[model samples]
Target: MDVVAFKQFINDQIQLFAEKLGDAKHSSNDGVSLGKLTFYLAVRQSIDKKASEQDMGLVGAFNDTLQALGMVEPGKTFMSKLDT
Candidate 1:
């Protein structure tokens, strides 16, 4: 997916989870914490060797977008299941 689409997808997922956790107003620090927790969990899961191909692809796209936006160093790896 393109960068814009990827961002939208992330936002949508976060919003869905926030709503599920009773953060429909999304005005609480707890909501932010939950979002961060969810994101990290997804990252960890994506880097697992047994992760689905789709999960890996999503994480790769996320890392690529971060690099492209200068949020991460170019060619710097985040999580590599092979390194474990």
Candidate 2:
């Protein structure tokens, strides 16, 4: 995909991450834990969504963002996947 589309995807996923995080941020119940889990899963899903595509470069980028956000370790991801 073009840079614009790739950027849009990243932005959309970031928005989703923020929303999920908000659920935890605003909740006072045990659901806050669930929301945190949701945030992690959502972040992983976002990276996986881009990883399972034609953009190897984008997958690297998504993974970088994950690491930058402290959501995942860099080497922990994209290690076992087949090379394109």
Task: Choose the strongest candidate by lDDT.
Answer: 1
Off by over 4 Å in 1: 1-41, 79-84
Model 1 lDDT tens row, 1-84: 444454455567666666656754555566565756467446555533555676577677878988888877877744421232
Model 1 residue 36 distance off true place after TM-score fit, in angstroms: 10
Query: Cα deviation in Å at residue 81, candidate 1?
Result: 15
What is the C-alpha local distance difference test score of candidate 1? 0.60
What is the lDDT, from 0 to 100, of the residue 9 in candidate 2? 59
Error in Å for residue 45 of model 1: 1.6
Each candidate's TM vs. the true structure? 0.43, 0.31
Model 1 RMSD vs true structure: 10.6
lDDT of 2 by residue, 30-56 (tens): 465554444444444444563333355
